[model samples]
Target: MVDSGVSAAYPIIKNYIESLGRSLNDLENILLTHSHPDHIGCAAKLKEKSGCQIWAHSPERRMIEETDLQFSVRPVPGFHTLVGGSVSIDQELFNNQEIYLEENLMMRVMHTPGHSAGSVSFRLSKDDALFTGDAILLPGEMPIYEQVDEYLLSLRKIDEVGAKILLSAWDEPKSGAEIPSILRASKNYIEQIDSAINTTCQNGKSDNPIDFCKQVLERLKLPVPLANPLLVKTFQAHLD
Candidate 1:
């Protein structure tokens, strides 16, 4: 499994895996995209049932290996409810690293940070498919990244890959010409959020990040549910 969904998705994922004619015990690896609770929620359970060796970047290792520390510091909303638990990473991944699943089948790790310090995307060398996990969110989605600059740079890196198949965690799989279009659109959405931030605080952004996030969301006419501490942190990235 590339990235496990929420804790509630465990049985669903397992059933799907079984439906494919493979038992959970047959699995051997769980490659993480980042350390976000939602992204790594069912990881622990998956690893436990399958004896899979989990792989994650060094920047995210601490969080992925220590759920208590993550909750104590970040304290994301519904953190405890969402995350199944933490599990140790068997191998540390890095930029340009190639992982062979089997003979003639390979996955190239792309260190596409920004969504998080350790965020990564994987490219299936044999099939030319890219599995981008929350690295390229669409316009209607809530913006949640650590650094706007890094996110933009990562987007450019993803574009350079020129993969024929673009499989994002958020959006439907896109292909061929649609890949670049979606990437460019994702970049533009970030730019739009940047502009909204500026417009919301035309008098200069407030020192209070939470308030600033609310103002920007109001300016964008985004849903109230989107206003949260993570979104606040995302807005604060521009200030930094």
Candidate 2:
């Protein structure tokens, strides 16, 4: 199977794979997008048992070489940790490189960073299916922002690729029709940051970025979670 092995994202994937009744030897070769545990967990253990070759970005080779406590936890909610294990990659992918799978299936590597420095997305030129690791999320009315600049660049790159289908790590299949809309929303969200900074400057209350984001959330019609401040803090990170 062309997977790093499921560690944190969902063990159900591994359960499902095992449930298929395929002999361990039947599944071979794992292509990883990055070193994230959810994507690369179970690689070493699976490899030891199944003898599958794990291929990932050259930088992620270290992931399999050792395991860390940091890689053991889900960075955010809607994510989970995989069992402990190290992964070793047999191959490393580079940008703008193409790997032909079958006559109809080939993946063109595109480095779409920001989520993680080495994060990447793969495009299927023929089928037009793009695997966006975590670069984009399904439309949530308001666009979530990363570090602003990097996130914008990644969005522009997605437009440049012009895939018919956008597959994200979090969302379901999306049509090209939603691309421009989400991009616009993402831009609008960025603009709100400017407004927040400017308002803070004018009011001399620049110290409270959280309150500024609360105002922005209301303007954008986003649900402000009362249980935790993490959601608010995440938005504040983009402020100037």
Candidate 3:
């Protein structure tokens, strides 16, 4: 599976596989796009049940093996503490590395770090698809890149790939003429975020990132609980 979802999702995955007359053990590899709890949550459980090898970018290996590393940066809410558990990485992927799935099927890894330091996107040569996990967000969603410049570069990289199908962890797939718009929207969103930060600064508000993000959120009419922290992080990236 591309992502394991949350821990409670294992049973659902197993059931879906069984419906296809396949066992969970038939699964051989779990390729992680990043080490986010929602994406790598059930990896350990799935590995225990199906003996599948987990693969992720080298920078993400330590986080997968020691999940506490993630929580240390982004503290987990009490309700989500059980969402993810640590798992050993059987293979550490690198940029431009090709993973041969079968005689004719192959996937190329692309190191598209932005949302997180270790974030990556996968390119399926045969299918002409790119699986981007949080490296790009849909329009209107909070753009939370740790490094704005890197994020812009990654978006350019995606545009250069010209994948027929664009798959993201949070948004529906885009294809054909719809694909370029995603890249454009991502870049435009970053510009919009920067503008918001600039406007906040012009208003002579507290220069504190948290306070600046609150004004930006209010200006954008976004909810505080959902958009505050992410905007603050994005503002910090701008500062950096």
Candidate 4:
């Protein structure tokens, strides 16, 4: 399994797996893309039930195992409700690392950090499928990334990898021409936001970060409510 939603999602995930003639115990590993609450919410519950080893990037290991520290650093609304509990990582993954899953089947890991410091994308050799977990941002949604440049570079790396199949957590499974289109769109979205920030600055720059994000969000015609603290980091990325 890629990621377990929240603890409440365990039953839903179990039902889905059972529909395919498998149960939670049949699961072997959970590959975490990042350490976000929504992504790793039910990891601990799933692991407890299945005794499956959790694999994630090294940077995310601390957060995945220490829920309180995560809350203190990246606190979110309803964070406690979203997370099941902390779980230990059996394996810490890194860029260019390859995992042999089965006979003649292997998976490659790419350290595509941006959305978070430890975000990663996995590519399976069986069908040339790439699973990107929040490393690539989508349009029409709140842009939540730590570094603008890292995000863009990760997108470029994903593009260069050139997988025919693109599986993302945010969107439906995409293949063929849709892959490039989505990559381009995600990169363009960053450019658009950067432009909005530059335009806002040209108009008038604010000393406060939240105020500055509000101005940029307004320039982008986004919801005023979108100008929150999480986005403030992304907004600050432009200035930095």
Candidate 5:
């Protein structure tokens, strides 16, 4: 599987695999797009049960193994309990690295760090599909990043791929003509957020980040919880 959903999702994944006439043990590799808890939650357990080798970008290896790196938000209540435990990466992936799944199946790794320092996207050479984790979040969903430049660049990189299928972690897959628009929309959303932040600061609405984020959220018609700690961090990243 490209990215395991979460710890609670293991049974579903295993059952799906079995439905395909393959057992969990039949799986050999788990390619991670990032080290986020939701993305990597079931990796260790899957690896333990299936003896699958977990692969992730080198920068994300430490975070995946140690589970110490804080990407966007500080751990809130039940954070550890909800995110589950960490897993060790068996192999470290690099940009442009080609991973062979079979004689005819190969995937190219792209370092698309923006959402997190070690975030990555994968392009399936044979399928003409790009699996973008949180690198390109859907509209109505908050996009958090530690670096704005990196995130923007990553979006461009994804666009350059021109893949027929664009698969995102949080959003439904986009194919054909719809794919390009999704990429453009992701970039445009970030730019709009940046502009709003600048305008808010210039108008001297609220200097406090929390209040500033609220103002931006209201202006954009996004929910408070969505903007609070998540988009708030994105705002902070831009300010920094």
Candidate 6:
């Protein structure tokens, strides 16, 4: 990861990979799900060292190139400013497409946008393992998605995939009924936030955004930390 913060600059897994007698140059390709810094932070350096081909969705093409990066406070109504970074993707992937990496390794590309306009997920059909970018979040916590409707749709699509193992870049991997259950909880939380926003807005209480968000959590009997700015954005998207 690039130096966004203290922990952000360091590549935690780089040495470990190198120790396995796998040089950076040994990697065949780099698959990117989105342009978030935490995900794309070490990309440039890694690609430079390894010369691995980078593949990503078309919409995030400009972000990785470090061109026209925009940060907006009111990305949507009632939501806090979302800090975003830009990177240009070297290659573009499509929805419901399968890409063969090697004789036995094939990754199915699925465009499950929600965290961003061009978010994606990759699946190894044979292993039933899904790399769900940031579309599916951790338990008791919400991952920020710019589009609420798209996020819900993506969640449903995951069910259709019937992945046995759900792997997230930011959180622990999920198995058994964990992934499906977390998806359900995420949807439920979205609905709860929507309801809270409606009630708060109906009472003309949208002026105090922070208070409104806090109140919404209190009313829903949910943890404030769990229903953070990310969850708040989901609520804001519904209202929009």
Ranking by TM-score: 4, 1, 3, 5, 6, 2
For model 3, residues 29-64, the per-residue Cα lDDT tens digits are 999998878888889999998999999998878878
lDDT by residue (176-230, candidate 2, tens digit) is: 6886676566556566655654565566643565565666555446664431244
Residue 105 lDDT (model 3): 89
Please report how far candidate 3 places residue 78 from its true position, in Å: 4.9
Q: Candidate 3: TM-score?
A: 0.93
Instruction: Write down the lDDT that model 6 would get.
Output: 0.68
Q: After the best TM-score superposition of candidate 2, give how far the Cα of residue 178 lies from its true spot, in angstroms.
A: 2.9
After superposing candidate 2, which stretches have Cα over 4 Å from the reference? 1-11, 18-24, 59-80, 138-146, 190-240
Cα lDDT for residue 205, model 4? Answer: 80
Writing each residue's lDDT as its tens digit, candidate 6 over 72-168 gives 4223222111213343456688987788877787788898987888888899867789988778755445436688788889999988888999887
Give each model a TM-score: 0.96, 0.69, 0.93, 0.96, 0.93, 0.80
lDDT of 1 by residue, 1-240 (tens): 798888989999999999999999988988999998888999999998889999998999999999999988677989988999889899999989999999999999999989998899999997799999989978778888998889999999999989989989988899999988988998988988888987877867767777777788877778865678889888878868
Each model's lDDT comes to 0.89, 0.63, 0.83, 0.90, 0.83, 0.68
Report how far residue 226 has shifted in candidate 6, in Å: 11
RMSD of each: 1.3, 4.5, 1.7, 1.2, 1.9, 4.7
Q: What tens-digit string does per-residue lDDT give for candidate 4 at 26-46? A: 999999999999889999999
Cα deviation in Å at residue 137, candidate 2? 3.6
At residue 99, candidate 4 shows an lDDT of 89
Off by over 4 Å in 1: none
3 or 6: which has the higher lDDT? 3
